[model samples]
Target: MSAREPSYFAKCACGKFCAELYGEPFLMGGANCYCNDCVAACYYCDDKARKEGKTNISMRCADYQGAGAAISCWLLDNLRITSGKDQLRGFKMSAKSPLCRTYTACCCTPMIYIGQKFAPRWRAFNLNCVTRASDGQPLKPTEMSNVMGDFALKEAWDQIPAGQPKYKMIPWGLFPKVLAVIFLPFLFPGSTVKVLEEDRAVPGMFIDAAMVTEVVSAETYVAAGVRVPKALLEDKKGK
Candidate 1:
């Protein structure tokens, strides 16, 4: 069954993929993925927690929901970075593909997944963090129906969506900007990414991993979730 419970904390609602409903600036489409990649990316890839030795962690990745669907949006513009600005971290399935997914390193909150596996700069945010824009309404992700991955094949991926990449349906119009992300310097100005290279030699293959280095804002970490200490908040306020 698809997880249809909406998040009360999600302030932004990514636009649906219906062409008729959304005209120009198609924005981004949402999906419920249950592929192995999405599952592992949500669980493991916790270098921060591993290094910090923080066990008993609870994360909110897309798959945790029954449907396993996440919202697809452009992190560059769509994401407003309300809070937890400094706690954001990222990881990929492997070094070859740069489909990086993000989570809050502080609280282990799996928030978004971004990649260029099929399309350019695919920003798949955790739909659990997605809420209706008006009236702060909540959305039942499972009730919304699964788009990318299916519930029948939970662990197996044979029944996945058959589109361009044989896994997802990419909006061709968004290709221009998606492909252009590769041209931009690894450490572009204003990018919150920290590039980390893989040790294994891939010869001419892309083995670079873009990890988050620091979080600028220290006032608060997460909204409606983790919070910073009053002393820390006061210190930031003093500064």
Candidate 2:
């Protein structure tokens, strides 16, 4: 299942940066994560944009904050920075944190997140930044709850859809599911399946997360006007 053309197109708010995204969304495993990091990152991007006087870069920042989760598509092994890769910048929550969030330097549009969990193999694109589908229709792929219900802000937690399952952390079963998605093509090679090709992956950004100056932390989120969840605050205090 190789797509000669891009299935989705993602661009920064500034329109200076763009990427061609390929892969089936369902096969990629989309999810909504309610973890503190995910929530804080959204607030951080919004705050950064405001400070720089960059307008119209919202990309659902408030909506994600209000909904208490960040939805992402686990785009594994098929990404191409079509233009403005030089403007790509990223940051980590801390020196030790495995998560690295990349954004466009021009307008601070939060783009992709690659954590140690995904590592050299996968990248999760923020659903907000993915603005267009090749089909010219709205992009709506089914998603499952991924993690951290306890860290959602009170109001945000209340906004979760009824009957949607919430987890305090990533469920153990998630590992197997992820593994299956990654290896299925190799297990049964056929026209119906597609194995990820490193050669077609993102060529490389202007800078890796290591070079990004700012480090996000609890204090940083607070300074950015993000309301930390009471449960998260309590958990940190306990530690």
Candidate 3:
């Protein structure tokens, strides 16, 4: 990192997930997502692991980590995975949902939410998975959690920060896109479903974990990508 460029540390459970999120500190806005899409994304990795029957570590970092888990993040592209990039995987909550629910292939640690079609400027980091920086400070901590989605548990809504920004749903820009998807079929009967053009898998990607033989250590994990201080070790030291 350059003298002028500031950075913060974050990682997933069992040392399988970690990264130095680069950007202006606290420049990214924060929100608590109660959206089903966000919730589904949080569980996507776990669901995939079960379906694929791949060998993996215990479910430690786990799901979104219950209520009040607001994700504070920068743009999705800003996250530089320091290790276990192969473990990283993401899926759309729904075909029309904008957020690419991202997480690690090693375990179901809810990581970042990326945009596939829209809202490319923002990256939603799972606040639940963000660990402390080497300095023992939070990275892009949220001012408040934004409660979104048409349906959310009433108990979950009660956990919103007393003084932070809380939204009933997503930003105003999303309404039009959602409406179009909702009404497109009705407006034009027999219209085909819209799919992302870049959904095809690219070359050099391993289809299964058994295909990879390289040993991955959490310690080597940190230095593999962006540089982070020695003070912040993997969340689970020897797991």
Candidate 4:
């Protein structure tokens, strides 16, 4: 229901590791990443985990923020790891961005990509590690700044339900039209517009995958409220 409710649980591959949601989910939509370091890190991590016998690992979320506000919460300092600690590994990429560290501990599965930047209050957790009864369908990509690969965003748009409302208020289908009319000029050019897409390989990173469509420029299309087919988007070329 609401993001305030306890709706998600993170677990490792062995099902021994778990984390509870205590905050609203932040940045719960698609992102495009272009950073080379981000791409290298994700590839290395995923490859290493696969070799370690961890496959099909992912995070889970209770609700899609694209449909509502992100769940926000303070990290539970006393949370327990039920298993797979011996294989857990952590890496710190940038010192300026956030105190966040990516982890693959507990069965060599990519666990949480948490940070303290939104700290003293909110923390963003990777949705893939969360557990729930739902199929994790309409899977929303939260961040995309770290992706170095290509991706298809149109496919993701197709997954979102059409009848829903924007921000849980305005009618969903008409939301784009409203934005298009309101920001027509900015949608054209002579403006600093950046289009983003989600890199499935990296959690919480957005890369620039705005070239997947031809209907209109990414900026104009986004401003006009047209949903791009995720199938048209492609993740980075390799792994």
Candidate 5:
């Protein structure tokens, strides 16, 4: 089957610049990020550039699809540059990183990073330079790793719903097993098959309605530094 397509539009702060997206809206699942590089880039370079008399710190680009020739043509022809080409600057990181090819010249803003990498047959319009209102909300990461571990927080993942049309969804019931099978190897040091098997047997017992009372009691007991079962608690409280 052909891969899914996602697209988005971005604009600069001035409202004078805008770009269109034509490919998969997200490059990776849940904002896959390389923490060391991204953190250094954002804090030392991007943040510094902004502090140095940079009013329009935002950069914007649109994701698109189609052949490379067509995509390049579209970007050059259609991308409306509303302001400060002189301020633009492109920075290159690893020669292997996809940004190497895309971040050719930082003519408009030095801090703004733009580059292309082989991604699910899609493109990412770096959002750092977006200055227009139409640039849409900040680019929510599709996958995030390391950093503040904010991405690991359950609340962060809650923003997206299950079974959204644009993306595939894993059933909540299957999540633990799926995660164990897929990620446990990388997360844990040893063989994951056994761990995954064990995990699958438990299979999110905390969320099971049948175990809610027990789970709640365990939580309360733990909070109180006591060991009491829900049944015992109920009995003692005459509930």
Candidate 6:
């Protein structure tokens, strides 16, 4: 991607946070991910809104009453938090979880998720956080339904329209795609991948991983006066 390539803007509902996503959704593609963890992340953010007395604030993501689906895309070396970076914070479903999803503290909008596999090389942006594509084009369409079907979120699972392809989990092909992207900067030195300088500080980037909070169980939300989503409660029962 060139420096002048069309970029996408992802802003939190309160207009307090924004991220510029350079380049397009690469090899990993986009999807409506209905995994339990994703749903919980939405509910957690919604609860944050309610607790902050910003009940009217939109979290910009959801699936149904109790379960949620995140319209997300995986990109390599393409994200830059342009504003309200100081207000961005990360949380994990559990201490052992390898993923950390970020929320805009000002409005509780979950903006991005970073997985442990490749660190800062790649990040997943919640498309719900993106309200505009600067290329004067429509945002990328979701290419698949992931972690859906006969598993997870009984109530919301039935709500998904039939006929489209659904996967119980991400396909194995994704691993290789991610690996390829991780190595792309080496193969093509002219690629648009940005590398952070040692002394530079970029909030919302994975560098703050040490400060991420761990939400161990439903009680963790209760203690904070936030209701745990029913989908998460069901997951606990099944486990």
Whole-model lDDT values for every prediction: 0.39, 0.59, 0.47, 0.36, 0.31, 0.60
C-alpha positional error of residue 92 in candidate 2 after TM-score superposition, expressed in Å: 1.5
Off-target runs (Cα >4 Å) in candidate 1 are: 1-29, 45-69, 115-122, 139-239
Worst 10 residues of 5 by lDDT: 65-74
What is the per-residue lDDT of model 5 for residues 1-239, given as tens digits with 9 covering 90 to 100? 97322244444344343445444333232222222233223323323445554444322111111001101111222233333333233333332233421221222222323322222122334445322234455545454222122312233223333553121232244346544544545677574222223222221111112221211222333332223334544655674
Positional deviation of 10 in candidate 3, in angstroms?
2.7
Off by over 4 Å in 2: 1-3, 26-29, 59-66, 144-146, 170-173, 180-211, 223-239
Question: What's model 1's TM-score?
Answer: 0.44
Model 3 Cα shift for residue 15 (angstroms): 2.2
Better of 3 and 5 by lDDT: 3
Model 5, runs deviating above 4 Å: 1-7, 22-24, 27-34, 57-88, 94-98, 101-114, 127-239
lDDT of 1 by residue, 69-164 (tens): 345444333233444434545554443334545566554545656543432323455555454543454344432224344222343334334542
| lDDT (10s digit) by residue, model 2, range 76-104 | 45666678766766676655454567667
What's the TM-score of every candidate structure?
0.44, 0.71, 0.53, 0.40, 0.33, 0.72
Q: What is the C-alpha RMSD of each candidate to the true structure, in Å?
A: 15.6, 6.0, 14.2, 14.8, 20.1, 5.6
Ranking by lDDT: 6, 2, 3, 1, 4, 5
Native-structure RMSD, model 5? 20.1
Candidate 6 Cα lDDT to native = 0.60
* Cα lDDT, model 2, residue 141: 60
Q: Write the per-residue lDDT of candidate 3 for residues 1-239, one digit (tens) a residue.
A: 65322266556656676666766423324566664444434344444556777433322222323233356655434555566655556554322233345556665565655443333334456665565555745544534446563444455455555875556776665467546654666688776343333322310121222222322223332322222223223434534
Q: How far is candidate 1 from the true structure (C-alpha RMSD, Å)?
A: 15.6
lDDT at position 132, candidate 5? 28
Candidate 3 lDDT score at position 135 = 70
- Point out the higher-scoring one by lDDT: 1 or 6: 6
Best by lDDT: 6
Better of 1 and 4 by lDDT: 1
lDDT of 5: 0.31
